[model samples]
Target: MIIGTVDCFPTKSTLSKLSINNSQNATGHWNSKIQFGHRTVNKQGSPLDFKLEQAIVSGERDDFVLITANFTVPPRSTLPVDYELIPGVGYYKLHKEPQDWHTARVICNKEGAHLAIINSHFELSVIKMLYNRDPKLHDFSYVGISDLQKHKTFVTIFDEPLNATGYTNWAPDQPNYDGNCVVVKRDGQLFDTQCNGRFPFFCEQTLGK
Candidate 1:
């Protein structure tokens, strides 16, 4: 299971080398293939054997192509993505910088996850711990709570009622404005922020096991 980000450009080139985490144990050798339509386009003549964590990819892109591998694990093993794992909950990932709520959610979806879901106080605490880990990172990031319908009621991206989470930690007089998105502050309190505001985000994924 190799889970990681990738930097790409507009070129007819290939990834010379890259590393991804692997959760599988059978590591003798696996065949590699690069197919475009009906043609094999590997730069190398033969399908080479890859190391457990190393992968070789070849492609010709005239335009931009941004591809990131999602973490994969066996059905019997624990989750294997490279992110903070909440034991009873699931996996969570904190982005490096701030982005609008919509962009953050889109990116998280691309990474095979969604914005962090705060269903309990413990889950919120896990998000806070992840936020405080980096001194360079700000105190808050976008979570999955929002009032998309503008009905004066909040709900999670997963379709759960926010009040039902039973773990409201809003700041003083927070959500007093027209803002619909939720953010976790440095003081470990949640606040309602504008959806268009750019803030770092946390993504959550369930354990496949």
Candidate 2:
């Protein structure tokens, strides 16, 4: 009785190192092949001795061979590429490209995420760290706060009041502008800005609330 389960958790760098081969079968069907030979490690940097022999994956119109080592990746370890999961918080992606608030929201929505809404000081710190990862990501980035519906009454994309997020650390004398959109500075403080102004933004996908 051999029951096996496979989980895949590859980082951006690891994915780039993978070799994918596409070839046609004898029945004139294309088969996808992925080879993984790199060392697998856990969070503690300990090497895991798990090797894959071969796996046949049933496809819609065809079948493919998935070859890998014997490894068990828990559900929590599996996450979408390009998103960094903050424990007890959520997954976040920082877009370097500048986009207006509305455009940013639309893009995030398309990706099954929303413009990032700060929930706590810890979350705010994580966002600040991500925002400062690249030197080109200077200045501020658009978040999910806006006063579009009512003047000076900021609400998140989820329609929750900004104050309810438990993180209302606004920049010194900020909200000074007669703007509807909000931006979080590198220092982890919020500021009101015009919705039409282009800026890099953060997208967040939350798990069970």
Candidate 3:
């Protein structure tokens, strides 16, 4: 895991460059402030093998003119296995194979984090990084917001009870509101979904105190 802060312009370039090789592994957003890169480097200070370099160079340069690159981490090993953890990000392990929305929330809360809340477009992109990695997990899974009273549905993680007024992006007839749980989909769309649906869960924890 490599975490860095780049200027808006070069960030787009890096993203575009990375996407070409690993479309499923790259993500970017308008106000990320920080970007996550999956590239790895070997112990000898050489770039390790990864498929993230081809996605950006397919002539999509114009879409990434406002991005920049800041910092990068070379891979490291601990006890014969190579693993890297970003400084300010949080990760959770699922105790069971799959958990429902409510169960996931409880687990995250118990773990000292909480069901991830998309506070901004930057955070939304982070959620997307987690959502797209697993197909067994539904495209959309429960987030941390709800509206059981008047709306009978969950609000978005951003806490917008009502759709962003003129910026509604729900699927047709969404917000059905059977159980009042918030869910985020692979495409970053939000919907009021039932809490009973089983899916892999994600949590957010503050870093560095």
lDDT of 2 by residue, 71-137 (tens): 4322233334677766556778999999999999999888777899988888888897897788667
Better of 1 and 2 by TM-score: 2
The 10-residue segment of model 1 with minimum total lDDT is 36-45
Off by over 4 Å in 3: 1-96, 153-169, 207-209
Q: lDDT for model 3, on a 0 to 1 scale?
A: 0.52
RMSD of each: 16.3, 14.3, 14.8
List model 1 lDDT by residue over 107-146, tens digit each: 8888878888777767767877777788778777898889
Give a tens-digit lDDT track for model 3, residues 1-209. Answer: 23443433335324222321112224552333333444333453323232333233334455443444444333232211222233334332322245787788777776566676655666666666655556566566666676755466445444565444223455667767665776667787767766687866556653432
- What lDDT score is found at residue 78 in candidate 1? 28
Error of 2 at 202 (Å): 0.4
Q: Which ten residues in a row have the lowest lDDT in candidate 3?
A: 16-25
Candidate 2 TM-score, C-alpha based:
0.62
TM-scores vs. true structure, each candidate: 0.59, 0.62, 0.47
Off by over 4 Å in 1: 1-80
With a 3 Å backbone cut-off (N, CA, C), the pairs that clash in candidate 2 are 51-69, 51-70, 52-68, 52-69
lDDT per model vs. reference: 0.67, 0.77, 0.52
Please give the range of 10 consecutive residues that has the lowest summed lDDT in model 2. Answer: 40-49
Superposition error at 169 for model 3 (Å): 4.5
